[model samples]
Target: MTQELGPLAREVAMSYYEDALPAHDRFHAKRVRDVSIRLANECDEPVDRDVLSAAAWLHDIGRPLERTNEIDDHDEWGAREAAALLEAEGVTSDRIEAVACCIRTHSIRSSSPEPETLEAKLLFDADKLDAVGARGLVRLACIVGERSGRTGERHAVIDDTSVFGTIASDQPDISLLRKWARERLDRLYTSPGRRLGESRWEFMEDFFAQFDAEIGVDGKR
Candidate 1:
């Protein structure tokens, strides 16, 4: 099932992400797909790979619309759009609904639907996993850089092996990223997800600790 729909869904998702931000680009979707499959393999319960794959690929398709204020919620919008697109592709109603349900609740917004099924929970965990690790820092850096009008500076800081030495100690973006990462760490659902997230969270903490020490922040010498 996924063998056919996966490629088709990816192609459709790519079109939507053609001009997307670096943080939420098509590659981000691909990473989420990989994580979803990996987590699914570790689960004791059965998972519908077809629904998971389709949902992972199409999850962020409405991001561009949301970014432009054309839509208020990408998850909800993407779910509806995915259902229509899958229906057009001759997918069964149940499969389309399954995929849509996963997309509709992938994010942790208050208004977003709660993930009810194992597939949806996996998708949710996979998506959030990208927001807390080394990759998560890079994504947040890209976003913060873009917002602060310092993309080149932020890239330079990230590219440096001695980034701590070069980075500003009091940058608000770093604080924001830390806060967001902590929140994401607490939001993980599955046991496998929690295990993976805990490891990543530790890495992030170590990185930040070193960063603080190098820059003489947090009273570190």
Candidate 2:
């Protein structure tokens, strides 16, 4: 099943993500799909790899629309879009719903629906995994830089001497983003996900520690 649907899904995802933000581009979808399959192999229970693959590939298809304010919620909009796409591809209704469910809840947003199926949980975990480690920080920095109209100057957001001068003076967005990434370490639903997330979270901690030390925030300079 995946052998057939996977390529089509990738083709569709690439079209939507071609002009997406750096943080949520086609590469991000590929990473999530790869990680979802990798984690699925380690699970003790059976997993619907086809559903996971389709969901992972299509999960962020609506992000470009959301970025342009064409849609209010990417997760919700992506779910509906995935359903229609898969249905047109002649996928069964049950499988389409499973894919839709995974897309609907893959985000970390509080308002997003909770993932109930094993495939949904794995998709959520894989998506969050990409938002944590070294890669995660890079993605976050991209978002911050883009938002501040300082694209390509990530140091201003992640390693700025001014921003790190004092804990109280840290930019609110970066602070909230850091807190959000750290909290994902605990929100993982699977043991494998937790193990991987902890390692990534530790890297993030070390990075901030070095960042602070270099900026004299720790009084070491």
Q: Which digits, one per residue and each the tens of the lDDT, describe model 2 over residues 107-141? A: 88899888999999999999988889899988877
The TM-score of candidate 2 is 0.86
Predicted candidate 1: what Cα RMSD to the true structure? 5.3
**Top-TM-score structure, candidate number:** 2
> Which pairs clash in the backbone of model 1?
none
* Candidate 1 lDDT tens digits, 1-221: 34487777887778899878888889999999999999999999998987899899999999888877799999989999999988887888998899999999999877877899999999999998898889988887776666665343432233224344644443443567888778877888898889899999999999888866775543323
Candidate 1 ranges beyond 4 A from true positions: 1-3, 146-173, 216-221
Question: Considering only N, C-alpha and C atoms within 3 Å, which residue pairs clash in candidate 2?
Answer: none
Q: Worst ten-residue run, lDDT, model 2?
A: 152-161
Runs with alpha carbons beyond 4 Å of true place in candidate 2: 1-3, 149-170, 173-177, 216-221
Q: Rate the local accuracy (lDDT) of all candidates.
A: 0.83, 0.82
Question: Each prediction's Cα RMSD?
Answer: 5.3, 3.8
In every candidate, how many clashes are there? 0, 0
